[model samples]
Target chain A: MTEKKKTTIVLFSGDYDKAMAAYIIANGAAAYDHEVTIFHTFWGLNALRKDQQVPVKKGFLEKMFGKMMPRGADKMGISKMNFAGMGPKMIKHVINKHNAMTLPQLIDMAQELEVNLVACTMTMDLLGLQQEELLEKIEYAGVAAYLGEAEDGNVNLFI
Target chain B: MTEKKKTTIVLFSGDYDKAMAAYIIANGAAAYDHEVTIFHTFWGLNALRKDQQVPVKKGFLEKMFGKMMPRGADKMGISKMNFAGMGPKMIKHVINKHNAMTLPQLIDMAQELEVNLVACTMTMDLLGLQQEELLEKIEYAGVAAYLGEAEDGNVNLFI
Candidate 1:
């Protein structure tokens, strides 16, 4: 019998679509019956946080003022695009329309599917996010810890 | 009137989920009238290539072997974890399941969306892929080219 492949997805984009992609992929891996693990790092850490606030970016002039300010992921949120101001509402509509899960739904699916979810410690520190602020189910680890997981998998995705 | 936000997505992962995420985001961004660009580098380039081929590691042993193979995101195709026996089918399944388009479809979406699709020249050279081998619509540029775009945007995503 052929052996099952081990896969790990390292998510770095905190944006909605990117996070949704990670969630979908993790769900796909689980469907295939592979042991899947997701590691959230840097900006990717934002989505895993329990606070889940939107990110805010400075205006063009504000960006020009100096070093620029940190943009929170929650504020810049994924624009639903064609739905006009209805991107978020439409997203929820479409996901439900297609029976596809939402980001939060995907997150729930990850648990039901038993995918390992880990948040990067370094990013958490850089962002000043406390462990208590992230989803309680997520495991916190350093870069080395993530590398250890990567070392074991044949598939590693930086999303 | 508020100045429009121009966004660039730096795609580095070639996994099914990541690819799906980039596409969904691009499609969403286009719907919103945002100027969007996607720069494909490293493993991300694979999904864009005409000949899309990725090796699936079978088991623990194969994964260990994969890790020892190389650390860089060079020509060695991105690894798909535990693909087991169904490689081509799996790829198709993902594409169809998500109503996701192919590399060709993705390119078309970018064009229709006016999303600047760039192929990293350095990565192309490393992988022995000439400009001709890539989708006809893509622009080939170096890292500096992509950085220039990112420097100006209020939004940047590494997916």
Candidate 2:
């Protein structure tokens, strides 16, 4: 049997637009029959959070992170021209007008396409995110696990 | 002479962190003796802005863009955890503490290393950024020009 090509993406941004780009690329790579793994770290972890606040215990720093950062994809602002939060609303309007999938929808599609969504344990520990705060059916690991997958990957990217 | 492998980076975000990543990768590629071209567009155009605002005449929309967006690298915000602009300052502090090159320095190094920097003409026109408002050394092109470079490149990334 032919060995499948692998694509690994280190998603490190939590901006709605960047998250959308990551998912688009991940889904495209999967469609081409590549084994895809997206290592979501730092701000990228925000994408995994549920919209509603969950009752999860955390330390002082973690609690601060949970309160300050947006709940999930729905609350993410644009990377630039945020204009006090109006930019994202405009972008969402445009996306809907163009019949493009929302960031949340693309994420769900990525899961359905079997793109491995792995949260960074180190970031989680730092930010004080609990497993219960994120989506289900995802993997959690440290940077070493991501390195292992990326070691043999034909295409590796940090987005 | 043997042809060098080309790496094309589409820098679409103008946030300080994203711009830092894009420049770091470009510089890294140049260090590896790869031909690198960074196509800066939309928000990415802000990266090329002058630290001190130049007296370039712009139309109504262009003037609006200029007034709303950050002046240059030093003025950019973080992609997430901005905390109303404190996040970038914190990142800058960390960057300084580590003795890492600042974003402007990275751009300079990339230029010294002969990494091609191209501005998107369409975006510039849309954003009302005149060439005089940016650094003198750069190429200006549309999507087709970028596609031409990307078509033959071995590695292509969008940031």
Candidate 3:
């Protein structure tokens, strides 16, 4: 007999495409009748903002460092896959390409599918972001809270 | 003129769909002309294995624990995602659906497109997997080595 599967997705990528990927995967799991939870932290929190992501240019030193450094988030933050200028565009394309859902869709899907959504308080503090600044229906918690959820025998994923 | 992008991808999910997402994104980046790297570790290493993955069952105690648990990879080992039973099937579906490239195809694209593939040594140690056991193109490195790549800037990701 088929047993139930519980999966948790941790989003660390603040990048649009990566976040989209997480959202899509979570949505897929929900479609498959799996319990899903998403923990957003760090740059990942940027996706939770109710506005467009403002590109921040590094200062002279940072720019120089960035010049010598890697240029994309996947490489810098999660995995080193440069989305180039196409990161955001490709995200929209694939989502459209697959008729895949959006962040809001994923969020609503999370609720309808009973997926848990948790925002990292520590990350919020670091970013000077308030819980109220996030979209409605998000649960605010700390790393400890996330770890507690991760302790369950299901599956945990970092996106 | 658009500047060049250096990117890297860290893959921890061995599940087929998640791995396909990484590859899809990598292919997209390569199409856009960027340097890419993928560091696979833990369950992510399962993608590199020649044999199929063995399904894991939760014992009675594990089942009870699952009831109270968050259901994720942290409890399983390191940071990874449990892709449900559909993982392998979904991977095959998506790949076939897209006429998506094989791991070798993706690797070749990375090579032709200058994508670097690295395997995490720490995870290899914990999992008792050997370097020789992986695909020929894979390069093994310690976390520090990955950090070195990240420290130099470019892009770093943990997926």
Highest-scoring model, TM-score: 2
The stretch of ten residues in a row with the least summed lDDT in candidate 3 chain B is: B69-78
Query: Would you list the clashing residue pairs of candidate 2?
Result: none
Candidate 3 lDDT, B5-111, residue by residue in tens: 75667686644446656777877777777666777764576666534222345444323322322222211221234355444445545667888675546655665
RMSD of each: 20.5, 6.6, 20.1
Candidate rank order under lDDT:
2, 1, 3
Residue range A1-159, candidate 1, lDDT tens digits: 976666788786655777888889889988998888888765576667554433344333322211121233332246236356666666667778898777877888898898988987654543345665567688888655554554446566767
Error of 2 at B144 (Å): 1.4
* Runs in model 3 lying further than 4 Å from the true structure: A1-4, A52-86, B1-158
The C-alpha TM-scores of every prediction are 0.45, 0.64, 0.43
TM-score of chain B of 2: 0.96
TM-score of chain A of 1: 0.76
By TM-score, the better pick of 1 and 2 is 2
Relative to the true interface, what fraction of contacts does candidate 2 keep?
0.06
lDDT, each prediction: 0.62, 0.84, 0.58
Q: Which portions of model 1 miss their true places by more than 4 Å?
A: A1-4, A51-76, A79-84, B1-159
What's the lDDT for candidate 2?
0.84
lDDT of 3 by residue, A63-156 (tens): 4442433232222232322235433443344445445465556556666877777889887666556555566687899888887776662545
**Candidate rank order under TM-score:** 2, 1, 3
